[model samples]
Target: MSVWPAYAEIRFADYGEDFDPSVERTEMERGVPKQRLLNTDVLQTIEASVQFRSAQAVEDFERWYFIDVKRIGWFSMEHPRTGEPINARFRNGRIGRLQPLNTLFRFAKRDLVIEYVRAPQ
Candidate 1:
């Protein structure tokens, strides 16, 4: 039987610093800091998602997800020919990749809903 790989749905949101940076940009027509949000506001916009990763991925995202792995998901195959268990069979295996953190962050008004579900270790 195939094992239900361990996974996690981490949800994080941040509109940068507590206060908008002094260099707050603006729209072409408005000619001012059009609109922005506080850190808490962003914390509430990011949608929840799941990512299947080895134990290593947990620490990686926890520390560098913002830059390395923006979004989160189960990629079909990370290492296809390393003599390892490849996950290329969409019919039975899994795939991993970044989710929709980009679009989610772009939205100034959205609800944050991250769902983390990992198989018991």
Candidate 2:
């Protein structure tokens, strides 16, 4: 699996835990309502902002993202909070537009949202 670039420094911008539970609702003989919840785990998604300090780094990221991942493949990156590698895919299969901090392209930044593919074992 492809790993995140070492040159790119990821900063956690937002973290969200998503929960969608299966619910069953039934009416009792006495006209009472009952609800049952299914067992499930909360999935996680991370919105991270990364900065590329040099033009070469930005170019490398573009190549990695577009060529290596093809924009829809799974990759591994260290979690900012847990500091463990996590399998993830691009959320909506896209990254936000990269913004250059200067005309010389010495620095750039972009935001990314990735969803966890599985829980850590």
Number of colliding residue pairs in each model: 13, 0
Error of 1 at 121 (Å): 45
**Superposed Cα deviation of residue 47, candidate 1 (Å):** 2.1
Tell me the deviation in Å of residue 70 in model 1: 13
lDDT of each: 0.31, 0.78
Model 1's alpha-carbon lDDT is: 0.31
User: Per-residue CA lDDT of candidate 2, range 26-102, in tens?
Assistant: 98889679998654443477777888899999999989999988899988888777788888888888888898878
Tens-place lDDT per residue, model 1, 1-121, is 1222234433233211121232434577645546553232221111323442444444444444333332343233222113333222121212234444343332122222322221122
Lowest-sum lDDT 10-residue window in model 2? 13-22
> Which residue runs does candidate 2 get wrong by more than 4 Å?
12-41, 118-121
